[model samples]
Target: MIDPRRLRVLRALAEHGTVTAAARALYMSPSAASQQLAALEAEAGHALLERRGRTVRLTATGAVLAGHAARIAAQLEQAEADLAACSAGLAGEVTIAAFATAITEVVAPALPALRARAPEVRVRVKDAEGPASHRLLADGEVDVAVAVEHPGPLGVGDEQVLLHEPLYAEPFDVVLPQGHRLRADARVDLGALRDDPWITPWPGNPVHDVMVRACEEAGFRPRVACLSDDFRAVCALVAAGTGVSLVPRSALRGGLLGSASGGVVVRSVGGRRPTRRVFTAVRRGSQSHPLLRLALDGLRAQAASLAG
Candidate 1:
């Protein structure tokens, strides 16, 4: 019979790409991981992994098995959660993935309160770009993920819409150093930036697409001056006069440079609004998990001011 534990070990090995890495992620010794995988292979009567120079990669069959393993692991985790809920306290670890602002504004503030009330529940965070963040959720790498839902679609799973508050209602702005030539105008016409240097994120990132679409709507292609996944770094580059960025006013709290701030300015296009609609997401089937529910409730309460 195929042992679930052995399948899990193989799944970890497949997901991590190396026995040593899988062992580290699973919190087991490399030898133990190898042993379990060996046993699983023996039970399955086939070669699940193929050897490379110093590592192993999943075979086609192994990849299929790993997908099943993920579903099983999720069900097992939910089962454990249900059992834990029957006890006196909420207890379990939940990994969360979120974009930059949510980590600082929403997650940081809400965690302390949530932890105090449910001391048994442990939370960890993985900083991710929006589209990437949702993929992490779909991959079973995290329990919850927070992201903005603007032109790019978010996950179709169960969601707790947090920005039900009015953080702001304005067009996204072009941020630059305090003394750029355009700062004088409250809104710069997009056509004027046809030849302007721009800083943006990696191609697949949510913000990168946002910039592209915004520029497209403005009837021009942005001349990308730099590539950075770090939102802070993107702003720093803008502050250093390296390039200009389209950022939400909220993010300006950290990225705007003084002299550069006066020089660089956010300008709204005639009718184009480059804005993000932020929300909290949980697996639709996972609402029964108390930790997920409570965290959403706390997020709602904290976001009351913004959602309004």
Candidate 2:
């Protein structure tokens, strides 16, 4: 009989494409993960992994087993959910992953309400970006994830193991230094800032992609003077008269910009304003669990409050 835990490790290895990455995601050391996979191979009586130069790939048999592992994992999740439903009480722990801004504006505000509504249910929060959070949720390391929709298809391998619950649409705003010419405008036009130095997120960041696309639509590329992933740092740079940046309105509301000195102003972006859809995701099988449902309700309430 195959150990379900070993099957899970194999599934993680399949999903992550590397022993080190899978081990980190599973919160295990590389040696332990290797041992588990080796034990799994012994049980299956076939090799599951082929090591290349500095990487590992699934063998033919490994791929087949991975498919079975995914189904078994999903079935196990369903069983757990069914058992939780039998109890019909919000008494278990629910882990959530979210980005920084959402942690402050959505999850933090929802915590008090969740505690009040279901004192027996414990909540754990992990701060991560949308893609990373979704990866954690997919790997079953997290019960739910709060994430933003990017400009493409969702999830690696297109498995659709997670179901989304839309929360709110967050619009981007332009952050400008005080006394800058653009700060005088109620809504800043992206084209107007084409010649100005820009402060934006690093390359490949979702927000950076949004900024780039917004500028492209305006018919020019931004002259990025500085790059930082931290919204607060972006705001601080803007406050210190370094360069302007685009940030989600949610970040401003969450005190990212407010914490910066008074040398910056936020304005709406003119012409087809860019926005990201913020949503919560849970494994399809576990969405109906009492604890998950209660926690989702708390999140929905907080999102509604933010929208209002």
Which candidate number maximizes lDDT? Answer: 2
Per-residue lDDT of model 2, residues 15-89, tens digit only: 788899889989999999999999999999999999888778999999889888877777788888889889855
The digit string of per-residue lDDT tens for model 1 on 199-271 reads 9888877668878888888888999989987666777778778877787655655443434444455555445
The candidate maximizing TM-score is 2
Q: Model 2 Cα displacement at 120 (Å)? A: 1.0
Superposed model 2: Cα runs more than 4 Å off:
29-31, 42-47, 51-55, 152-155, 259-261
Error (Å) of candidate 2 at residue 109 is 0.7
| Model 1 lDDT at residue 149 | 60
Clashing pairs in 2: none
- The global C-alpha lDDT for each of the candidates, from Candidate 1 onward, is 0.70, 0.85
